[model samples]
Each structure stands twice: as C-alpha cells, then as structure tokens.
Target: MLLKELSALASPLNDQQIGQLQKTVADLSPQQLAWISGYFWGLSQTPAAAGATPQPLAAAVATAAKPAGKLTIIYASQTGNAKGVAKSLEAAAQADGIEVSLYSADDYKPRDLAKETHLVIVASTNGEGEPPDNAISLHEFLQSKKAPKLDKLQYAVLGLGDSSYEFFCQTGKDFDTFLSKLGAKAITPRIDCDVDYEGDAERWRSDVLGKVKETIGGGASEVVVPLHAATSVGTASAYSKQNPYTAELVANQKITGRDSGKDVRHIEIDLGESGLTYQPGDALGVYYTNSPALADEILAKAGLTGDETVEVAGESLTLRQALIEKFEITASNPQQVAAFAELSGSKKLQKLAEDKDKLRQYANNTQVADVLGEKKTKLTAEQLVGLLRKLTPRLYSIASSQEEVGEEVHLTVGLVEFKNGDNTRVGGASGFLAQRAEESGEVKVFIEHNDNFKLPADDDAPVIMVGPGTGIAPFRAFLQERDARGAEGKNWLFFGDRTFTQDFLYQVEWQKYLKDGVLTEIDLAFSRDQAEKVYVQDKLLAKGQAVWQWLQDGAYLYICGDATRMAKDVHEALITVIEQHGGKSREDAENYLNELRKAKRYQKDVY
Candidate 1:
C-alpha cells in the first residue's frame, strides 16, 4: 500500500487523482491487476500526447514491452503437462522482454514452419514413442512429401516423458530429427526430461532464452499473448503440480465387482472451495505420502537409523521422514539400478547392469527396497536420497465433469499392486489412495487439463467412444457433460473388459444413459464371456459398416484405453473397416484415418 495510495508517497497527484487511484484498485484481484498492468503497458507503447501530464510510475511500470524478434511456441501434450510447460516458458520469455506466440501443435499450420523466425516445441511422448493426438498431424506433415525446406528457421525442443518407458522422450527426438532433415538450425539443443521434468525444463528455458537474447536484442514489443498467471484464487487456478491443494477424500469404493481380477477404485475428493477447474479429459494428480511401512523397510535395508538426519527439498528431516515424504522408492529404473550396482559392487547387479535391456528388465521386475536389500549396501541418508528420483505424483484420468459435479472431481483409479520377491509392491499414489488413506482423510490434488481430448464443439455431431478397462473414465465425464447440456448428438460407446459380470466399469451409469436415450447405441465386449475372447476391437469389426457410416456422417471418433494393444488393434480394425466399406487400399485407409485425425474428427486418450 506504500505508493498504491498516491498520498502515501511524494507525488504530484491531486486529491481527486488519489481518490480515483484508490477506487481503481479497491476491488481489483491479482489477475485484474495483471491485466491492467498489461493494458497500461500497451498504452505506453503508443507515444503520449504532447504537453500531457506526467503519469504515475505504476502506469509506466505496467508497460507491455517485449524483446526483439518473434518467437513461436507449439506444444503437443496428451494430458496437458507439455502445454503447461510451454505456457510457463512463454511467461518467462515475456518477462525477458520477448514477444511470444503460443499454439497447440494442431493449431499451427505446417506451411508456416518454413516462415517462422524462431520456434520452440515442448512435446511429450505418448504411448510407445507415438506422438500425442494433437501432435500426430504435425508429426506426419513434416515427414510428408509436401513439407518445405526450413533452412531459414531456428528452433529448440523440450520433451517430457516417464523414463520407466523404453521410448522415453522419443517424440522430442523425432521432432529434432525431422527439423534437422528439413534444414532448420538449432537455437539450442533439444532436451529430453523424465517425469521429474520441472528442474530440467527450467534449465532448458534459461539457456534458450539466453540464446534468444543473444540473437535478438531487446527492443520495443508488438505481439502479446496470455502469460502464465501466478497461483491465486481469482485466476483459473493457482493449484498445480508445484503447489497442489489438499482435498479431503470423501469416498473410495470399488467400482468393479469383487469377483474381478483387477482392483479398480472409484475415488472422490472434496475440493472444498479450492476453485480447481477441470474438464472431461483432464487428469487429477494426487500427491501421496509414501507408505510408512515401505519407507521403514527401505531405511532398514540401507542400515540407517530412523532418526538419522537428511536434507530434502531444502529442509532437514529424519531419514524415515525423508524417505516417506521426498523420494521414490517403489519402482526401479535403469539409473537407480546402475547407481546401486556401482555403489555396492554386487556381482549379480554388476552383470545385470552391463546390458541395457537386461538392466531395464531388472529394474522393471525389482523394487528399490529389494535392490538395496539384496546386496546389503550400507548408505548414508544423503547417498540414499541421491540414488532415488524425487517423489512424483500420479495422474488419474478424471471421471466426473465439473459440468455435472460442481466443486468436486471423481477419478477411476486402477490399483497397481503386484508381486516382487517375498513382498507385495503397490504403486505410491494408488496404494495411498485405494488402500491406505481412510475415508474423509485429506489428500493433495491438482488438475492437469487436456485440450486435445474434448467433446465435439458442435452439440449435434455424433460421437463414437471406445474405452475398455479403466479407459472408460473420461467417457463417463463426456456423457455426463453431454447429458447436463441436453445435447442431442448421437452417442455410441464400445466398452470391453475381461468379463461383463465382474469387470464392467460404470455399467449402471451407461444403462441409465441408454434408458434416457442419451446413448444412441452401445456395444459391449466381455473377453471371457464365451470360449473366444471378444474384445472391443472385435465388436468394432463386427459393426464396422456402421462405424464407417458414422465416419462418413461427420462423427467424431474417440478411443481411450490400453495404448500398447487396444488402441493399435482398434486402429487396425478401423482401417480394415474403411478399406472394406470405403473401397480403399491399406495405405489409403490409413490416409483416411490420418485425415480424420488432422480434421480433429478422431482423437485418442490412450495412455
């Protein structure tokens, strides 16, 4: 409030002017302050009228000046993490006084690539090195015969993915390769980051901005885009991966029958005025406190006393506390295995570490506790923390639309529990939410928005959704949202599982939707119902004609489920249908599907 009230400082403002300034800020929220700041900045760019009164420093401070040259940022994200990162980079670039234009990968025209002066891509690898739904069009276009030479362009890329997957950061690699082949110059080398991406992302941003600053000297600005907002209640959200809100767990129930082989949970959390906004395809990220029981086992295996001191995230804590609150100990990876193998010199670990494939298999099959326990590696608290990745939250596809449930979000969480050695291993977040956390207990959560996966903008457009197993989460949100809006679009759903009797997720809701005529047609597939396994793809082939007809009728096709097999098989089935019904070769049929994707008529929420 120092200089905010004009009278508080030595200023030339008259009483009336002071009163006006106070009134202007009286009801303004943080975002309003930010916008007004930009607004005045735009005004400052225009030369002031001659002989006009000198304005307050605040007005001058709000200048929207930018650095020299234009920078284009395009992001391809399935669960919105890359978009969030891209937006963060845009804000940072704006702060450095650079003009930035942000676009979803699909929104940017391929023809424009040859013309871009400066471009940066923040892409996340989807399943098995595949480009995300939004990235597919651009990915294909660059490799297509129509792509132009981009010798005139300068670019950078930042890829985000989980290192546990074999093709970690493969999308970014592909993008870099394609751009190089097209003759584009690298502004800064591409950086591939694992799930613990924020730190690496920050470093990449600083280095890239430094390069931009060197290439394009700061000067007067022109274009302006939405900068990332500081976390506050007034904006869309302040709660995110960095600072999640603590929401209470109101319900945690088993959605599937007790007889089912898989243990999937229906989870609900009370937002409690957190103002967290999410749509149908968004994900709920839950930060869990590692199971104390497991944490103790890890500490004991390292031969460290529970009370031994350790530092994590800049705070000092006991060894036990740090293990539970700071590091990832459940899943093993190549890096972790290599670190342990080298530290302990275990002949068995040494042999496994010699080969990449064998190391990966060992990591996948083992746990952190088991690795340390196997070799009795005596380690200090610091050494142990140094060996592990920072604890990261797990994201579950949101099942409830805000349109249907205000101030509350639902998640379909499939518990990840399996056997390893003599003990049972459970996923960090999944174990916490589904097994450990009691009803009404608090849980930390945030929304990861997905713009690529959305309902048809046209209410009358037909939609075909194929989601089997826990993949049905987002479709539930879709139907709920459609029902709430009284949409008249025909809805067709093809859902499958091992058995209808025990594995059909949300069966009651789909039946209710059918009864209400909201669902135009429904096809069910229960793999174990008969002698032959009948999955969703089987059903799709059975009704291939109708599916192809829907495509011809301007239907939007959506697929969510297992990316490793279900998505691929369903894709093959759809191609076969197009070939048979539309009378085309395999290549033409594939082209047809690609066009559908390019037109945004086909979308997948596969993991």
Candidate 2:
C-alpha cells in the first residue's frame, strides 16, 4: 500500500527507479527505513533550505552527474601481515570517500572479478613460493582456463616476503601475471617488499589512494567516516607492532636438561590491566635489543669505532647504539652479503654472491660479523650501517590460554646460538628472553592473531596434532582452552625431539593431563634414543590405521613445526596413510587432504 501510494504521488523517479527502490527497502528495518527517508529528503533540499550556508544549486547538480566506482581489495595471508595491509587500504579508501569492499581470498568469489572496476591484492608468499592455504582455491581458479576476462579492471598489487627466500613475493607476482593475462590494466607497478615492509607499504598505500581518487569521482567528504570511529564499540587495545606494551617478565625457566644440546626456556609474561586478549592460536611479538658485546664485535669486524655517528629513521645515534638498538646484526641475508661484496670489491665474495643457492647457504651459516670479516675492507660509518636491515620483532606461538591464565601469556622459546670461531653469536630476541630479561623486567610485546590456525568450534570433535620441537606451543594452548571449557573432545598429540629424557618438554604437564583424562592419547618419538632415527613421521606411519579411523570419524588435523623438512615429511606420511587405509589412489588421497583444508579441518602454524 505504501509503495502504491508512493507511486501515485507523482515522484521524479521513473518506473524502473521506483522498482529498484522498493526492492532495496523490502528487507530493511524500520530504523534503517527511517534513516533512508531522511537521507532522501536531505538530497532533495537546497543548502539554504537544509539550514546550512546558502550555496548555488549548480554545485549539487554537478555532484549528481558523476558516481564513483567501487574498489575491491583481496588479501592472501598466512601469518596476518598481508591482511593487515589490506585492511589499512580499505580504511584509507573509505576515509577518502571511495566506495570500497574488502574480502579474504577464500571468501571472495572468482566471478566477481569481472564486475570490479578497481582491484588491489596484498599477497604474502608461503612455504617455497606457494600460495597460502586459504588462497589456494582462488589462485587456482585465476590460473585455470575458465577464469573470466577482466579487460575493464584496473588493478595494483603489493607483495610481502623475506629477502632471504629465493622466490621472494612469488605469490604476488603470480597474481599480477594472472590478472594481466586476463587483460586487466595495471594502475601502478607492482611493489614487492621485504620483511621490513612497513615503510614501503605505507608509500604504496598513499600512491594507490591518490590514483584511485583521480580515476574515480572525488569529494564526498561529508559522508566519510573514520575506520576506528565506526568500529570503536568492542575494539581491541591500541597496542600494536608500532606501539607495543611494555609487559613484565613473570618467569623464565629452563625446560631442557642441563646435558642437552638445546637451551629452551618456558617464558611467562604479565599483561595486567592492558586489556590485551588473545585466543589459543595467536602469537606474541617480542622486541629485544642486541647485546653490547655483540654490537662491539660487529664494530670491531667492520673496522669502525663506536664513536662514529650514523643516522637511522631521521635520528642520529652512535654506530654502536644503532647496532644495538636499530639494526639486525645476528641474522645474515643474501642482499646484505651482495651489498657488502660490491662495497669491498672482493672477487671471492662477488663470485659467491653471483650464485643464488651458494649465497643463501653462506648467509644462513654465517653471522653479520663473519660476513664482514670475509673481506679486509674498512667501511665508513654510513657504509657499515647500510649493510644491515632494520631490526624486526620475533613472533612466538602463545603457549597458554587466557582462560587458564588470566592477564598473562606464555611462550616456548628455543635459544638460537652458534659459534663464530672463538666468539659465540645469539639470536637477539631469544637471548633476551632466556638470559638478559630478568624476572620483573619489562619486555615490549604485542599479539598477532592467526585465524588460519585455531581449534575446532565443536566441543566434541576429535583433534590430531603433530608438533616437533617448539611446534608444541599452540597445541598446549589448545588443550588448556579445551580443558577450561570442559570440552569432551578427544585429543591426540605426536611430539618428538632429539632424546626422550633430555628434550621431553612439559613432560609432567602432559602426564598430568593424561591422568586427568583431558588428553586421550600421546605419542613420543625421540630421534636419538635408538640406533635408527625415529621422528614424528615414523610415529604417524606406525599408527596409520588409527589415524585413518580418526579422519574417517571427522577429526581435524594440525601441523606446527619447521616448514622446510618436518612439515613436509609429516604431510607426505599423512598422504601415505590415507592412500593405504582409505582405499584410494595417491591423487585421490591428495585431493582428500585438499578438501579437508578447504573445509578448515587441516591447519598449520609453521615457520
């Protein structure tokens, strides 16, 4: 009746416009309808009549002539960095009065690409140049023959990865190539950023927003809303990588045996009153300064005095201070080696840098001081500072549930130490937590939430976890949450290390959980306990029948450990188990695992 009355009222809208308006408002709430009614009435009024300063109606007429195009942003992320960048882009675009939509690669439909006028992708490379698990479906669709042509699409891409990897930003390169082949025009050159990507990412965001404003009709600032302003109802704390919270170290106890080759610390940090909350699968990012002795050693190796001043982030500091607080000196990368080789004009170093494989090997095995010592060249203060990348925070998987330990977080940290001739090198963050950080000392920290790795939502669902070494961190959190919630789910853990007695981390806790009926089953594989090496993969194969039965009964599988060898070996072992017990071919088993991943039944948190 209202529609009929509105139609009979001699409205300016034609029949088609009226029909669209009716269709749009059919499902709207009374409050939404009231807001729309006011919006429409305001659009019909002149500036003077709306109680504003008088303005000519010609400006309003011109504003109605152009409608802005929509901007679509998709993120393919493994560890949340790419997603963060995409969210910033969306917020910036909205603040500029542009119509924008954001989607994870998994949630977005491939067919929508043809409808998008402007598209931006922020992708991070996973493993050895592979797309992230959530992005596999979309990545494959774009590469397939059935993908639609996007000739009218204007796009830009930003890639994030570590420069140490041979195939840095390979996933972003793939997306750029795939879209270009489908005839989409690139609005700007693709930017591939290394681990220290904040600066470059901010610049790219500015450039992209500027181009978008120019291409689309601009100046709807009246309707613009800030992202934080709109979402402040249940927003998180302001502490982030840029602005970290200085939390106190509650405890740092050694979990490994004294005779063991490894040094692992069970770290506990107090987050009292900070309102920083996290789930089971989240990671804690820790910022630590390098030791003075190590910084002095680097200065001695570079043939520079500690008194030389160098500039960092527009601030001048002594070379030693910069080394200790601003730059990464413990880990060596291929880019640093190549730069130093060219600066020193060393033929041996130059030849080593020419080969990608050898250069990566050399960088991985050598430290910054060792790399500098390869040549006898004396570099200036600026040159010495230029050879290193900025210090980045280390992320550790949170090992305790907030439900179990209120206002506190826990971590399993393995000390990274190696010998450089007579000198010993230690990882900046690990060494800080294990040795330098005293109980009650402050540590700058933030949480990194990873949705890709999480527990099953169903309380009764069974879970199988494979975590060797420090990979057991998140699983510990998972069990804690499950126990706290009184979940009836069955839990199985496959854990391994060098030796059973020396490296069985949290053995008493596991035993207690088993006795309390919280943990259903546990498997241990100590590689050096016997003559023949036995790992988690061996344990999985040994329990192949039961593993298959658990999968058949709707079990979720998780893997957390070293990505290079352990994760790959466990994956292949699972495939073999499936193929042998499920009566399927090798390809079918692989497809079954892929289906599980798509269904969020298979998850990984590997580094």
Candidate 3:
C-alpha cells in the first residue's frame, strides 16, 4: 500500500527527479523507509498541503530518524540574480554534509517558517522598494498581525541591488526586519551587495556555512548525500559574468532611420558553436574596455605614467591596462570619494564626502580623473589601484530568435550620451559598442537566462507589447520568434518616442511586419509631434476598451523599458482600463492585475 502511494505521489516526477529519488532511497531498509515516510509527511504538513494533515508522532519519529542537519533556502528574485545567489548558497551548504532544499518564494508557504531551523533568504528589491512579484505574499504574511513567533528560527539574508537606486538593498533590509520582528534569531548579519555581487556573496556564504557547521557538527554521515547528486542541472557553465566568451562581432547595422534621434544599432555576433542556447527574453552580457581617450584623460589628470606597473589582487599589470580593463574609471562611489579624501587630505574631497546628497552629486559629475585633477596630491600605484572598483559587464536585451537565426545573437542598443558642462559624457558599454568596437572585433559575451519573462509556450496565445524608446528591443525578438514559428497569435505593439520622423526604430521592419500580417496592430505615440506630450500610457488609456477586450480574450501583456516612471504610469493606466471597461471596482481591478501577475499573463521586462 505504501509503495503504491509512493508511486502515485511520484507519478508527475520528471526523469531526473525519478532518478534522484531512486538513487536516494535505493538502499533504504524497512526502518529507513518508515523514517523517510515520516520525514515527507512532516514536509507535507504545511498550508501548501492543507487538505492532508500529517500525524504528530509520525512526523516526530521521522524527524528523529532522518538527518539532523539541513538548510532551507528561499529566494525572492526579481531579475534572476537572487535565484543565482540562492542556488550557489544551496550548493555550498550541501557540500558540507548539510541537507538543503531550495525554493522560490512564490512556491514556499509562509506557514513553513515555523518548522525551519536554519534558513537563508536571498531577495532583490524592485521599483520603489516594493517586494518582487514572487515575494509579495510572503512579505505581506511576515508583516501581518497573524504572523507566528519564530523564536526557534536562525536565519541570514543576502540582498542584491544597484547603488544607483535610492532604496539600495531595501528588500533584504525588509526581510531582516520582518524576521527579527517575528523573534527569529540572526545567524549572521545580512550582507547587502551592489551590482557586482559575487565577491561579497561568496564571503556571506562562507560565513553562513560556518555558522551552520558550528550549530550542527559532523564532517561525514551515512545519511549525507553528495552535493552534486542533488543538483537540478548537470555541470555549471564555465563562462559567467567574471569569465565571459569572447565572440566576434559579425554584423552591425543601424536599425533606426538616418535622421533618428536615437542611434539604435542591430548588432549580430557569432557564437561559433559555443553550445550556448538562450530564450527570447534573455539578456546578453557584454564585457567592454573603457575608451582610450577617457583613459588618457585620467592618466594626464593624475600626472601618472601609463607605463607604471600596478599590483592588483596578486597580479601585476601596466597602470593603463589596469584602468582600461580592470578598474572603474567613469563612475564614482561614496566609498571611493571617502578613501580618496583620506589619502589625499584634500578639503574639497573631504567636504564633498560629508554630505550624502552633495557626495552623490560630486560622484555623478566628476570622474576618477576629475577628482584627482582637482587635487595636487601625488599617490602611489597601490593607492590608485585600491581607490578603483572592478570593471563590470553591461547587460543588453537580446533581439533575435534562435529559430530565425541559429548560432547567432542579436542586440538593439541605444547609445547613451549626456553633456557634462563643457565635455560630452557617454555610457561606458554603449559608447564602446557604438564608437570603439570595430566590425569583426572580439566582444566578450554571455547569455543571462530569464525564466520569468518568457512568452507563452502556446503559439496561439495573443501578445500585447508596451515598449517605448529602447524598450522595444525584446518585443522585436518576440515578433520575429512568433513569425518564425508561424504562430497564430496576434501581436499588438504600443511604441512611443519623441518624434515618429526622427525617433522611430525599426520602421521599415514594422511596416514589413504589418504587410506580412505578422503584426496585428501598431500604435505610435510621438510625444513632441502634438501640442500636448503623449506617451504609451496615454495611448493605452485611449484604447482602454479594446485593450480590456484583448485581456479578456486571454492576451498576454508585456511591458518593457523604464521602471521608475513609465512602468508605474502604465500600471496605473492598466488599472484604470480594467475599472472603466470591465466595470470592476478600483480594488477589484487591482486584484485583477495581481491575478494576471500570478497567472503570468501580465509580464514585465522593465529595468
């Protein structure tokens, strides 16, 4: 009877899952089977399986018989970064003879918190410091009055975010606060990491693992399974953010018109049989060197020889190479300014560092060279090297389909430029691709897989894309993919720019798509053309009834581009559409949007 039930329970299991289960319980004796049964029963006691209740004694017996050491890691990922960190943490924890179970926050029940002994929470903050979609319910539950006391729980959190945002690492901070409020004990202090998070994440993992080992001691045990045995995927990729593949640029063409305000390029690269496979919504990470002009300017300002040798992290290289390829020269941080002020004893640097707002202003306006140029102090090579942060890769949305163009990756990039007083400032990555990188030049690239932002598997499902400015990139890929698959889905695009004549991107292709019947509708919002500035949100409002009808017809809505303002306004507009067209109350409309999010009908690739 037990074996039959086990088989029934495992009916939906995949091949890998079935194999793993068979391997794990292959040598189990009758006693071990009884213990395993109880262990699974305990896990099934939560609200996730509320219909079936586990026997108390059975659960206790199972707990006593099974391995005492285990780690529960929950990740609330907005853009897959937190998921990556959680995966790494689970791997590290399991390597040390600790049983580990990893889960996305959306899949994990809040009630399970009471039973967890060792927990690690990895989360990323979204727009306006709100929790990621996956973490919304869990975050609310922890803050609710009904939250259970978690006095027995010991946990740690790792936060991933960008420093450019005001609420840097806000989600992680919220998690820490919630856990502490519920009486959970801290295993270690939470580590808030910036965009370049690997080094800090590794250190945090080491600390957490150390604490776990200290709490539960054992080098080896009979019940302990090898870490690799429990891995969901096979061997990990060798290339990552730190180490990327240097692929050659095969094609570079201006997708936009000659008179366009935005210089959008359609770039293609040869993967060269690297066996890299990426879905439509994934981003391509490009590693680029700083411009030679910028590097020369920095060297001249600092009064340092480009040929001077500098030792960085045990490797010695020319100062120019270090600045160009290794260190961050353009962007300034508070830490960098503080360090420089202390080193140089400059009153201006020290004064700038005192006020947070003023410091940020200074960092934004001044480059590393500009800061050094203002001061007359001389610095050693080591000091200069220490002042700089490691150069990081930039991620651009992929705009091509493997089905359409196999073994090749395509991107749509908008060159970033701004005037800094008398001098013109350009974005490091965009400028490199636009001006520096030559045709057939080598570009270090890698694919970042995004599981959350994929088109529906069913080709018949309709899609509505809301993208303005450079945000139209992935939508182009979506249309191409749908066209390649010969999908029956209707594609509707709502695009906006300053002017249709000067800023329209992929105009010819869009026309071609319209003629070919690949694109069902195209709505353009040329803001400056009219007396009143119009945007995509305004267009959405204008076509509220039709948009609502499309939603009713099961169309997937995807929004891309600016997260700060546009995404928020579009969201509000969507709510208004639902309210007016669907005849629903404001709260009901809000819930409707939430339901769409839960069902993955409303997806966003906003950044």
Candidate 4:
C-alpha cells in the first residue's frame, strides 16, 4: 500500500530507487523502518548531500571510505566493570570521529592481533593473577610461543581491580607486559584503578582518545552516529548505579533455623513502575548506608568529634555523615593500614607495615577502629577521612526468575557480622537489608547483567549446579526458569552447609522440585553431620563416575560460591575426576577442563 501510494504521487526517488527501497522496507519491522527514516534524515543533512562545502564526514568518505586508522578495543571483564569502561571508550571514540570497533575478549580472535594498528585492552583480574574466564584463550595465546611480533601496533591498557587483593590488576599487567614483549609500542602508560575508579578512568579515557585522534586522520565532529544505532535491539531501562530506582522492600524472612550459626534472609524487592527486568544469573546492586553506631565508634577511636566538617568528593559534610554514608569503615585494606601507620607514627603499626604478609593478615582480620586505636594520636577530620575508601554498592545474585515472579526480585542475603574486641561489627549493605531496613521501606537498586554466566541456550542440555550456602541464589532462578519453560534437560545439585536441619537453605523447595521431577538428582553435604567434615568437593569425588558420564554426555557445569577456597577445591576435584576416569594425565585433565571453559560448557560465578 505504501509503494502504491508512492507510485500514485510524485516522489524524490526514481522508479528503480523506489523498487529498491520497497525491497529493503519489506523485510524491516515497524521499529526498524522508523529508525531508518530518522537515519536517512541524518544522512541527508550531511554536507555532501546538502550541496555545501565538504566537511570532515565528506572528506573522510571521499579519501578512503573509512577512517585512516582503526582503534580496536577488547575487554576482558569478569563482573562487567571492564566491559562498561570499554563501552564508554567506544562511545567516546565514535564521538571524536575516530574509527573504533569493540569486541569481547572471548569473541575476538587472538590470531588477528597482528592486523590491528591501534589497540586498547580493558581487563579485570579474577582471583589471584588469573584472567577472567572469557579472556583465558586470548591471554594464553599471547603468552604462548605462537604469538606474533607487532612492531607496528600501538596500544594502552586499563586495569580495574581491588587493592584488597594481593595481585591487584594482575591480568591487565600481564596483557601490558605480553604486548610490550611482542614489540607493540605503548600509546600511554597503563593505569591500574582501584574500586573508586571513575575519576581516574575518565582522565585515562581523555588522554588515550586525544592521542588516538592525533594519530588518526579524523577531526572531532558535531554530527556523530546516534547511540541507538550502535546499541542492541532491545531497549533496556536506564536504571543504573548512577541513577538507581527507589524500590520497596517487599519482604525479609529468615531462611535458616534458630540453631544455625549463619543469619540468612530471603529478600524480596518490588520493582513496581521502574520497568526493571533481569535474568537468572544477573545481580542486583543495592546502595546502603553504614550503621550510625559504628560511625560514632570510629570517630571516638580517632579522638575526633562527630561535628567536625570534612570534604568528600568535593562535597562538604560533617565527619559523622561522611563516615556513615560516604566512606567505608567496616573492611580495612592493607593500603589504608599502611597509610594510617605513616600518619600515626606508632612503632607497632610501623613495624607491622614493614612486613607485607603480616600487614595483609592484620588488615583482613581488623577493622578501621582497631588500627586507629593503636595509638593515642588525635586526628583532624581530613586526616581521618583520608584513611578510608568510598562506600561502594553491594551486588547480590538474583534468586527468582521474572518468569516466576513478575515485577519482583528476590535475593538470598547472609548477614555479615564479626566480633572486634567486645563490639560486634556488621557489613554495611547486609546490616541495612537484614536489621535496619523494615518492610515497605525504600531501597535504591539496579540490575547488573552478567552475560558471561548464564544457562545454556539449548534448553535440552543437561546442567550440573554446585552452589553452597548463599550461592544457591542463581540456581533457584535457573530452576524456576527451566520449570516455566518446561525444559527437558536433566538437573543435578550439590549443596553443602554446616548442618542439615539448621543450615539447609530452601530445603522444602528443593524437595518439592525433586518430588515433581523438575530436579533429576540432589546431593547434600552437611559438614558437621558426620564424624569428619565433608564438603561439596567430597560429594563430587564420591560420584566421580556419574559426573564423568554426565560430562561425556554433554552437560554444562556451574559453580557459584567462595572463590578463595570452595571454587578452587571444586576445580581440582573435577580435574581429578577427569584424570582418574578418562585415564588422562594431570596436564591432560587440566587441558580438558580448559577446553570445556573455552567452549562455554563450564562456568562459574564465584566471588
């Protein structure tokens, strides 16, 4: 009908052009067609089409039909921070009229490294010095003997990590060193960012893009591509850390028995009119305030009154408010401890700071007040505030699928409480959610999408999930989604806790799933129920034959729990299973697991 109307009236295009336009529009949906109309208008406003003097766009197209040099950005992200920065760089580059392309480290072929002219790597280290799961292949290729020398390449690296870890930004450091060894020139010095990395990241982006603009033959342009043109097809809500949705706490029910040592709460939050939606493996980032009592205790230890004025991130506020709402006081890091030791000049702290191992141990076990009370020195507000990092939002895995509960999100939160002398310290976010927050109270939250950790696209593929304690959150969502979709895949769960009756989280729900045939198999490992302590790894070892059989039959494996110990132990257990059952050597077993990871058959969301 549109083509007939165009034929009936006078049009801008000739007969052949009209027919071609019709063919193109025939396959496009309404949204795509509307977007094309706006895009065509944008194209018409270009200088070449407007019969004006040639500008940068026209000149660029006339010269080579593309920009002079290519700026390729590859991001190796574990929990999405590095990916976010890489996307920002891509947008900035496009705005500067530079030819930029972005790819995840998983999708980018390492063999194509020699073809790049300008490159930027945004990576985050996993646990210790390991690269993220998606980056393992690329990282390994660059370090192997097969790597190519790239004397013509110029690049820079931006590393995002936490200072609390021993090997801060190790993956980025590895990439930088690997590229340097292959003769790639550094465009700028590598920047290793701590948790509060926004300011530094912005500066680094400016410097790197300025350098690229000087080298690439494209001037900054007022007419740039629309962000929607480069974005994904679906339109996601604009709720994020910077602009969070004010959600209401629907419920906070304890999931553990009274005799349990752990305090775990099953939380439900109402998304309401926020238009927020999330998948099973995604997390919800919650902004919280510290307990006022803990803030007062820290101020008292520093020998400073709560009324002292302090400046935080260009905002002036009382020291008490800053401690309670802005800075982190519950968890102390080695960097902060070292800095505080220098300020106080306490002989004990100064001696402790000299030993890195002991300093890290003390920082991990102690709190802010423990370090401040080491000396009788009185500190000004500025001096005391400088000892802490900014308070960051906490991320909890989503425990319910949108399929199961509309306009609502669920979480399994364990209250983080520890003893410091006679005082009991609680984590900022957990304390807020478990103790301070009342039913129907407001909480700021946003969805954090995790594409790296998700169920297999094939609904018929079997899945083996090992999630202990609160790690059981995403599995619940996965099971709910599978049940909703009526997936025919076999499901197996290996769960462990301290006691069976006291610590078994969501026991009735798991039993229901089993009885209903949604769950194929279930294994429980109550560490204290037997004479000796048993964990999930022990269960996996005991069922090594069946685990191997399932793997051979094409099963996806998932692990979500403590990265420091549980994940490592489970990983070693799987390697052993492959070694003992497949009659493979230790190295071969490790390589088999690596291949599985590269194939996306094995995934982990360990913290």
lDDT of each: 0.83, 0.86, 0.81, 0.86
lDDT assessment of candidate 1: 0.83
Range of the 10 consecutive residues with the lowest summed lDDT in candidate 3: 226-235
User: Per-residue lDDT of 240-323 in model 1, one digit per residue for the tens?
Assistant: 677799998999899888888899999888998887898787778888888889998998888888898887757999988888
Per residue, candidate 3 scores C-alpha lDDT tens digits across 1-607 of 4333555564755555555566656665544454456555666776766566534443444444465546799998876778877887776664555667899999998998998888899999987687787888888899998789999999999998877566788999999999999999999999999877867887788788888878753233224222222322222556555457888887777766676666777788888867677778888889989977888887776668889998766888999988898888887777788788988888998998888778776876676766776677677767787888888888888888888889899988888776666777787888888777864388998877776678999899999999999899888889989999999999999999998877888888899999999999999999989899999999999999999999999999999999889999999999999999999999999989988887788888877
Off by over 4 Å in 1: 1-68, 219-235, 354-358
lDDT: the better of candidates 2 and 3: 2
> Which of candidates 1 and 2 is the stronger one according to lDDT?
2
TM-score list, all predictions: 0.84, 0.88, 0.83, 0.88
For residues 175-229, write the lDDT of model 4, one tens digit per residue. 9999999999999999999988877887898888878877874444434332223
Model 2 per-residue lDDT tens digits across residues 1-607: 4875777888866676667666666665443344444444666585666576634333433333334577899999988888888887877776566667889999999988888999999999987788887798999899999899999999999999987877889999999999999999998999999988877987888788788877874444423322222221122887776678999998999999989999999999999878888999889999998888988888887788899988888999999999999999889999999999999898888999999999998888888888888888888888888888999999999999999999999999999987878878888889989888774398999888787898999999999999999999999999999999999989999999999889999999999999999999999999999999999999999999999999999999999989878988999999999999999999999999988988889998888
Candidates ranked by TM-score: 2, 4, 1, 3
Q: Over 4 Å off in model 4, which ranges?
A: 1-61, 64-68, 221-235
lDDT of 4: 0.86
Q: After superposition, how far is residue 300 of candidate 2 from its true place, in Å?
A: 1.5
Model 1 clash pairs? 41-63, 41-64, 67-97, 67-98
Ranking by lDDT: 2, 4, 1, 3
Q: Model 2: residues >4 Å from true position, as ranges?
A: 1-68, 220-235
Clashing pairs in 4: none
